[model samples]
Target: MLKAGEELDMRINELKKYDTITIDNLKEIIDTHLFLTNVFSDISGHNNRSLASKYLHFHVPNMFYIFDSRAIQGAKSYVMSDKQLRASLAPFGDKEYIELVIRLFTFQEHVKSQFGMTVTPRVIDSFLLNY
Candidate 1:
């Protein structure tokens, strides 16, 4: 377990090298942290997606999102249109995740530029939840 923890730590450290994660670098990051691919199952009678999201978000807030139904809906509505989001979803892979991050970053930049609202990723996430 200590070795696993150390490996995870190193993977996270690799992620830290990116000032802003992009499609170009996302694969290497995810490849290192392969555990990120685990989806929730009811076998444990627990919401593992939420658990894992919180865990990863706690570590890399700017690069990850916790997408339950509401969050996914919110992300759909947060963008200009569903079609735009759908278009972005193509060739989905690690690229899709990076695109989501890019969308959030773009949304943050848009808000800052248009509304003069400087916000953190948490605030942006809240906006996604509420928007």
Candidate 2:
């Protein structure tokens, strides 16, 4: 989710406007979610302490909160028309939804493996059909 309720360009510009990020400033972000800093560590591959502090600013700056529904619809609309939206909203063209289904398929494979059950396309197709 986008914590900053603005375009990515605006977010970058805002950071450039500020020379440095301080420790006291990050306290408020941690107050809501302590594990927030760790989320960016793996992606940036930054060292623990120093990198974490910088990652925290990149993820969520002081006083900047997440807007759950960002300008995603607007961005998509500019790229695609209203007719395309109606067609794509249905499961077929939805990459995110398709990825979710594939993830669930993997989860099912793990659960079956635990029971010594072999996974096959037929089984997955059946499960998808039943659901």
lDDT of 2 at 32: 22
Q: Superposing all C-alpha atoms, what RMSD in Å does each candidate have to the true structure? A: 4.9, 18.7
Candidate 2 similarity to native, TM-score: 0.23
Over 4 Å off in model 2, which ranges? 1-94, 97-101
Q: Write the per-residue lDDT of candidate 1 for residues 1-131, one digit (tens) a residue.
A: 46656776776777677655454654554444235443333235443545655666678766556545566566556654334543554434344344454456566667778999756567766877776
lDDT of each: 0.56, 0.35
What local lDDT does model 1 show for residue 37?
A: 42
TM-score per model over all chains: 0.57, 0.23
Clashes (N, CA, C under 3 Å) per candidate: 0, 0
On a 0 to 100 scale, what is the lDDT of residue 75 in model 1?
A: 58
Number of clashes found in candidate 2? 0
